[model samples]
Target: MFQKILIANRGEIALRILRAAKELGIATVAVHSTADAEAMHVKLADESVCIGPPAARDSYLNIPALLTACEITGADAIHPGYGFLSENARFADILAEHKIAFIGPKADHIRIMGDKIEAKRTAKALGIPCVPGSEGGITDDEEALQVAEKIGYPVLVKAASGGGGRGMKVARTKADLSDALAMARTEAKAAFGDDAVYLEKYLEKPRHIEIQVLGDGKGNAIHLGERDCSIQRRHQKLWEEGPSPALDDRQREDIGEIVAAAMRKLGYIGVGTVEFLYENGQFFFIEMNTRIQVEHPVTEMITGIDLVNEQIKIAAGLPLTIQQSDVRLSGHAIECRVNAENPENFRPSPGRISYYHPPGGLGVRVDSAVYQGYLIPPNYDSLVGKLVVHGRTRSEALMRLRRALDEFVIDGIETTLPLFRVLVRNADMQNGDYDIHWLEHFLADGGMSAQ
Candidate 1:
């Protein structure tokens, strides 16, 4: 096991890694930007270092400074708790050159899976189901039109290097395809410095489900289970739950085995997620996240597995202690992301929090880095905290989440708490008949009426 590890990120996830390291008797070093000089993770870590200014390019995303911090602190491994450089293949290679373990997958695996075009190819080669689209990136509008016609209408044009819904456009007609392609290419070039874009058949109202897989360096891998992240806004997940409500027992086992086999075949290690879009009784691969997800706590709550500890152990040349059969899903879990934003306009509301209280009870967990009197800076993500609750069934979990949201309080700033309160009471959500467009429609239709 590594004696020390450096966390290369910020916010609640950074704090989460620190706590996990402490439990495993591993020292933690936190890297923060000038904006986060007094962040909660910095206070809890055994050591803290200032990397750069508030801008992500100079701070959290700066790879050289992170490597230097590791050298200065004598840390043997670096744990990127999502976002920033967590999925950067170059960063992984740099750590490998320095003989410092990158507590994730190999650089080659990252490189292969980071590009949407290559990931699709790899998934197809592994016999994993994928959405029908162009064989590779489209070189021009003509090729895009041809591919769109072949794939049928309602196709999506996506940047090869995109995530977070950036550089993506949906075209439902031939006339829209050319314009969408041009715009997506421009956005991809500006955002990712790559003009490459690919076309894929888009499934309207699909349920966004993902399987969590853990692997050892020795080619052994198993899936913890699946999470239904269909509750989202503009491609950002809002509410997530374990043992996806959409999957039957046979479907779950089938997808789980395929995902585990793909990971093992690719020599993937540590923790990762294989995302898919399910609609019309079929599943299609979307992309793979090379690090822990924000909604991972829901999976942990149901499985009772410490994913962070497992990542560290895998990096230290230890095989996974648990097998597929050993993994068991006990109950339904839900996570609602509470962000510091206006519930009406959905704009960032950064200010000093005058009053703060997190709900707590049996099977309720709160992951946050803010407190009363703490000023939410405008230089970072608007997320203030996450309220996660677990129960014996989905309906029971919904009831618990409603109660927990009512108990949560934050003053001096508008938040999405009200939004969740309204969501939990919606009939579509209550019956599990909601689709990806449900939230957008609900919000656009002036929200739900008072019951």
Candidate 2:
């Protein structure tokens, strides 16, 4: 194990990593922007350093400042808790050059999976199912049109280096192809500094399923099962659950084993998610997240594993602790991303939290860093917390989620709590009869207003 670890991000995830490291008897150094001087993680860490100003580019994403923090703190490892520099391959390489361990996958693996086009090719080479479309990035307008026609109507033009729904456009007809391509390229360049885009056959209704795998970079890996993230808005997942309602035990085992085998072949390290678009009883590989996911709590709840602890251990050259056969899904788990935003318009709501009360009870857990009177900085992501619940069955979990959401209270600002309250009672959500587009359609039909 590392003597000391520096948390390279802020918010709940940073606190999550800090707690994990503490459990492993490791000292923690929290690096934060000026705006986060009084953040919970900073206060809890053994040492805290102000890296830079409020802007992410000058703070969390500032590699040089982070390296200086590590050097000054004598920290041997850094745990990037998702987002920011978590998936930056160059950052991993830089840390390696400095002999500092990065608690994540190898730089090569991150590079391969970070690019959407290369990820698809690599997934196909590993025998993972994939959607049919352009074999590589399409630059010419004529080539883009050809690929779209071959893939049929309603093709999705996506950024080769994109996530979070950016640089993605849907062309429902031949006449829409050029405009969609241009729009996606422009957005991709702005968001990722790479305009390269690819095409994929769009599935009207598919569940967003991801397999969580952990590896030791020694050809040893295990899959913790899958999470159904179909309840999304603008490609951002809001509600996530384990043991997908659309899949059975057999299907789950089959996919889990396949993904584990792929990780072993690639010699992947730490925690990674193999995301797929599941439709018509088929799983199409979409992309791989090279770091911990926001919805990882759902998987941990079902498997009784600490993914962050495992990630740290793996980075420290520890051998794989659990076997595939040892992993089991004990119960249904659900996670609601409680963002500091307007439930109806989805606009950000950041300000002083006059009062805060997180729900608690058996089978309920809230991962958050905010508190009463904490001033939520408007410079970062709108997410303020996550409400996770587990139960013997999906229905039981749903009921528990309902009670927990009702108990959650955050005053002096708006939140998506109202949205979740309405969603919990909707017939479609209650019966698990929803797809990737379900939330968008629900909102389009004035579902929130009706509620």
Candidate 3:
């Protein structure tokens, strides 16, 4: 086991990694910027180091500063909790060159999966079904048109280098194909420094589903199940649930087995998510996330498996302790991301929190770093907290989430709580009949009659 691990991120995920390491009797070093000196993770860590200023570019994303922190702390491993440098293949390679283990997949795997175009090819080669589209990057307008026509209308022009819904443009008809291709290329170059873009047949009513898997990098692996991340806005997932209402036990089991077999064949290590777009009972694989996802809490709730801990163990050269037969999904779980934003306009709202109270009870877990009097700096992502709930059934979980949301209080700042309160009462959300576009359409149609 690693004696000391340095967490190279911030917010709830940093705190999450710290706790998991501590539970395993491993010391943790929390690296933070000046704005996060008073952050909960820093205070709770065995030691702390100020990496840089408030700007993420100079702080959290600063590679040299993080390596220096690890050197000073004599940490043996780095756990990049989800975002920031988590998926940076160069960063992982550098750490490995310095004899420091990265608590994730190998640098080679990260490099392969980091590129959206290559990831699709790799997944398809592994026998995973993919959305019909281009064979590779489209170099010009002619290629783009050919791909669009072959794939039929309603194609998505997307960046080959990065994701997070950026560098993407959709065209529903042949007339719009050229504009989408140009726009996507421009955005891809500006956002990811890569002008490479590809085309794909876009599903109109696809559900965003992802399978969670853990591996030892030595041919052993297992799948935890699937998460329904269909409730999203502008491609950002707001709410997530485990044991997707869209799939029955047979479908879930079959998909889980396929994912596990693929991971085992590829020798994929640590924790990773295989995301997909589902429509009409058919799943078309999307690009896989090379690191832990933001919605991992819901998976943990149902499987009772500590994914972070498993990642650490795998990085420490340990084999998976549980097998596919040992795995079992017990209940339903849901997670609502509480962001510091206006409920109506969804504008960032970063300011001092006058009052705060997180709901507490059985089957409820709140992951956050905010507290009363804490000032939320506008230098980072707007996510301030995550409220996760679990129950024996989906109905019970939904009710628990509603009650928890009512109890959660963060005064002096706008949050998405109001929007969630309204969403929970919607018929589509209640019956789990929503797709990726459902949230946007609901918002357009007046979210809640009272909102």
In candidate 1, how many Å is residue 415 off? 1.3
True-vs-predicted CA distance for residue 313, candidate 3, Å: 0.6
Off by over 4 Å in 1: 448-451
lDDT of each: 0.91, 0.95, 0.92
Off by over 4 Å in 3: none
TM-score of 3: 0.99
Model 2: per-residue Cα lDDT over 1-451, one tens digit each = 7999999999999999999999999999999999999899999999999999999999999999999999999999999999999999999999999999999999999999999999999999998889998999997989988888787989999999969999999999999989999999999999999999999999999999999999998889999999999999999999999989999888998998899999999999999999999998999999999999999999999999999999999999999989988998999999999999999999999999999999999999999999998999999999999999999999999999999999999999999999999999989988999999999999999999997
Clashing pairs in 3: none
Residue 352 accuracy (lDDT) in model 2: 96
After TM-score superposition, the amount by which residue 45's alpha carbon in candidate 1 deviates from its true location, in angstroms, is 1.0
Clashes of each: 0, 0, 0
**Model 3 CA lDDT for position 311:** 90
Error of 1 at 126 (Å): 1.0
Query: TM-scores of all models?
Result: 0.98, 0.99, 0.99
- Give the lDDT of residue 115 in candidate 3: 85
lDDT of 2: 0.95
Give the candidates in order of lDDT, highest first: 2, 3, 1
lDDT of 1: 0.91
